[model samples]
Target chain A: MSDSDFSILGGPPSERNDESSGGNRTARDDRDTDADPTPELPPGDAATALHRARLYSLLALGLERPDGNGGLEMDDTTALVNAAAALDRTVEDAATAVDDHLTDTAERKKRWASLFGVEEGHTVSPYELTYLPGPLLTTVRQLADIRGFYHAFGIDVGEKMPYRGDHVCYQLEFLAHLCLRDARLRRAGDDEGVTIVVDARRTFLEAHLGRWFWRFAGEISAHDDGFFAAVADLLAALVEDEIAILDLDPEWVPDTSEVTEWNEGIFGAAGRSCGGCGADATGLEDLEGSPGNPRNPGSQTAQDGLDDR
Target chain B: MPQVHNWQLNREVEFPYEESRPERQWAAMFDLNKCIECQTCTLACKTTWTHEEGQEHMFWNNVETKPYGAHPIGWDKRTLEDMGTMEWDGDTYEGDTIFETEDVDWDDPENHPTEERINEDVAGFMPDIEDDWRYPNLGEDETAGEEMDLDVHFDEDTHPIWFFYLPRICNHCTYAGCAGGCPVQAIYKRPEDGVVLIDREECQAQMVCNETCPYKKAQYNPAETISQKCVGCYPKTEDGRAPQCFETCLGKIRLHGYINTPEEADDSDPMAEPTNPLDFLVHQKEVALPLYPQFGLEPNVYYIPPTTAPVDYLEQLFGPGVEDAFETYRAIGDGEEPALEGLLNLMGSTEWSITAFEVDDGEAVGYYEGDEVGRVPITEPQTERDRVDEVDGEEVYRLDIT
Candidate 1:
């Protein structure tokens, strides 16, 4: 895929300009202000493509609580609302909540902390690896595979981005990046390139995001009914629509219901309780204490003391 | 009822099944001293057989740190407490077998344990969806005694605290508790290899096999509504290959082979016909002992007791031979005794079943199907290492090892 395809931020083929100028041009000089307007894809394809791109961008930005520095300006909020309306009316209320004062930078940060847990026990993890079954601390393979997908397209998680490669925000951002690439490929009439990009996006969706999105969305919906809940609905809907668009075999994808059940067995009410206080514990924090949580000193101590003889 | 001589117990015990002995009983030995709890064996077994949807919590092979680790959470302690403190007079154990311990009669297939037959003192446990279900790492790395300081060396003869990994799998016992407990005779031991398996079609989800098996290896799959356990990787073994766990063991601590029963071997000299490595360890040199032999299950799986763990604890677990086993293991590991050295070498000789083996030139050469397959050295070959500058401002170091 071309570099422009993966760029979520709209830009020209800067690599081509760099090669022509021997990399001596200023950032502004590389701008394609006078470039010709590209032909659009077919109506159905163009609308689906645009909707997917906008949805991904909105979900990516929305999942990460707004940073006070600058994020999701008026135009972005309008775009998100318009995109949500275009996709389905069910998400319209949630779309409007995107611009609510309660979602302001500081308030959103607090909400983020409450929703996606701060350290260990209290929050729902946004990490895809956490939802899978296996021993914790051996999550390298899954994380590496996700990183490989990003690296294959010359994308890297910025040092400033506070999320791991498997985090929902980063995953959504990756999908948005792929959608943007798909749009560029289609516009350029590079059918082969479009096919390759679409296939990659479909694989990513079926394997990673689509596999776990519903369970994650369920968790969010369970906790909230406003902005995030709406975002969750939008996410689930978008994934389903994408699966249909790509003509991917639904049978090949893992059933999210089964995954939800398995996850609940590990992190739900019937699962292991806090060894110290006997309170219901979920996530790694409750099992292994989160730093500075006085309720749990360390789960290792409790485990050690569980001698029946 | 059938009676079989259990050499570990030094007495014949009653078995519920008839005298239908296999042509060659499958046996294995685990060297605790070499295991590092890497979970390679566990993962290998998991990915091979138990990756299905319902088998998520099942670990056919699990390595847990003693005295606080167990896959089913308190499997050993609960069973031990239920059986009560066994009487050991030196090397001889005077204890009731699983059949003799309770009031239930073994001869009658309908005579299974009711709620009343279970001792009230011992906590009744079922592998439920709650605390007991998903605790594979519940007590992992929780060693006995105080945590030693960083300055304390592990090589020291005596340490304040220590823990060792105990890798466990289905023992495929001669008198399996699951087989005896099954009222429908759903759980059976194959006459060919003596590998015990639960017949899915015959199993009615009575969970008697799950409750009766002291080791708790038989797991209930709610989705399938049948209990399952390790099949001893029979498909691989049938083709003269080692099981997945044994083949993938990173520590090379596992040895799998066929062993003759007490009746089949020459009683006057048990080591006379020693062929495979397990025969040398279990029957001849007597370096490995079955786990919890006092339970009178005649478990085919044997263990070379951990050298570092406390003697009293080891004795309680592996019976009176723990000290002797440890001594023999240490001697074999150090290559002090040639016979023991040969046995250790043969343990890692090949991936295929070694029918006959001999120690030659400090290497254990193994033969399968009347042809030599591989040889393993008593000690691994040392690698040569050197560092040199290859170009201006560039340096590279290379070491040759596999």
Candidate 2:
């Protein structure tokens, strides 16, 4: 909405307007899609307060992992020791080997190369968001929106990175880095600067990143897999928590049932993006989950279907 | 090879101070059978906690119908595939529990703190930066390009058939995904309560956790540099009242309290009678019933099997077979990190825990098993008229819309 919003989005002024329009579309769609944005709310005032109560209630229902093994092969403590040892070998000591591919690229090398195209060599990994799908590029635009919101609240992503990338996480990291950066300068006696930066941390998180976060995550979750949904869920919880810390009344953290109804009617739940799904997506036909069905012997998942029956 | 976040994966692993105290022990339970899909829990949560800025993506609490549940629809397909175990439901897909990974950049950077600390284990750029939630799952801007049609995204089977509201927030796991996923060790579990949170000063928003979490609970905050996340409203609960969602719940379905133990293990009490439903859900491993327990992150959230979710859903998503596969995987020992099975069991097979609801008094019921926790009771049995009334009007329980 402002000139700064364009800059934070990673583009020139002219491209900014186009992107802003597009971004607005994204926001609008988030509110207008098949998702029941207007989810019914509880019958009470201080609805947000009720929301806060439920959040803590759910957080309490936690689970545990087998120290390292289901312990079938070893006992719980033994599994923990073994797991710790394995972590020393494979993870803690290893370099970024994850359960899934480190990067989504079909060809890690090619992907890495594109990302590390800089003449100075690869500062950024090629497998990073630089290699993701085009739509993913919009992450930059969202970043800009976030930046703009921060700016509106007088918070800057600060100087964590030389340049903001399209990656949303990276951009947020930039903000976190700024927090530490400011803290260091402050400890070095840059008290004034530190104060400004710390203040930015609170405002930026509550105002920009916290607002419309569910809408953003919903977009990712609607079409993506558990990874996206999980990501959305985590983000939703995190932002809400932060908003509470900041003492900012985030509308998304609905307390009243009316607000929930309103929210569902506007954005759908589970961070599920309804912005782009076609209108009237009301039947199994609308959701072609059949192909991904384990029942569909023709699908890749068929062979792995277990005999739960 | 373990994809260790250059920033984190090694901070002086501080034992949560409060968890050591017996009073800090906390837990939860869910009554799937009692749930009518009213979504009051979800709505109450949103309005009370998530309705504000930057939190549009979060649902600290939500209730959905069984089978083809969730907004994204088919959540189980990927869980099954990721876990390497799922059952077919003829033309439809069924639930299949999967394992999740705990890594850096798991949540959105703005949601938690990244490791920008001067020296706490992170070694790059003078400090490590990290985030809590990962993935840009929020709104769009002009820059995201054109609407890439949902068709272009992935499959429609993303939705399952037998829906049940799996209202979720943070599990506050013994081993939190948000805390473990921090590349810079910016996130940490509160010493007193074991609630995982982002250290504002330490977070630099590197996004390592964003990509590392198996559950994808972490997310990205676009242009922000730091990550953020849920804090359990410790400030509020410190007084022992209740969480925001719990307070706002019109149905009074939710309860709030503390968990006293650091480990969610059996504590030599497989059939130990805990105090509340929270205790039941918190000690899931004690019951040998897990919700994608294969993640190995040691989550703290738990759910009872949904009595009405349909047995077929359980078989297809996570039956004993998948559980066996996961158990076997756990048996593989720790030497091999193995690939992350998003929904698979420890043995890299299907694993799931359904939401089960039962009642003690006419109104108070048990939400889950393994622990002596109580949940809200269902007033009436399932009936077409009842369902119609629920759909046409709001009720105490969450009845399926269909």
CA shift of B288, model 2, Å: 9.7
lDDT score of residue B143 within candidate 2:
15
Task: State TM-scores per candidate.
Answer: 0.57, 0.37
Candidate 2 residue-wise lDDT, B124-218, digit = tens: 11111111111111111111112355555432322222345555556566555455445455555544456655555566666554434444444
Worst 10 residues of 1 chain A by lDDT: A1-10
Instruction: State the TM-score of candidate 2 restricted to chain B.
Output: 0.51
Q: Which stretches of candidate 2 lie over 4 Å from their true place?
A: A1-308, B1-25, B71-80, B83-161, B223-225, B250-252, B260-289, B310-312, B315-402
Write model 2 residue lDDT over A130-182, tens digit each, in one string: 33222332223444455565564454644633345333443344354544445
Chain A fold similarity by TM-score, each prediction:
0.62, 0.31
Question: What is candidate 1's CAPRI-style docking category based on DockQ?
Answer: incorrect
Candidate 1's iRMSD? 23.3
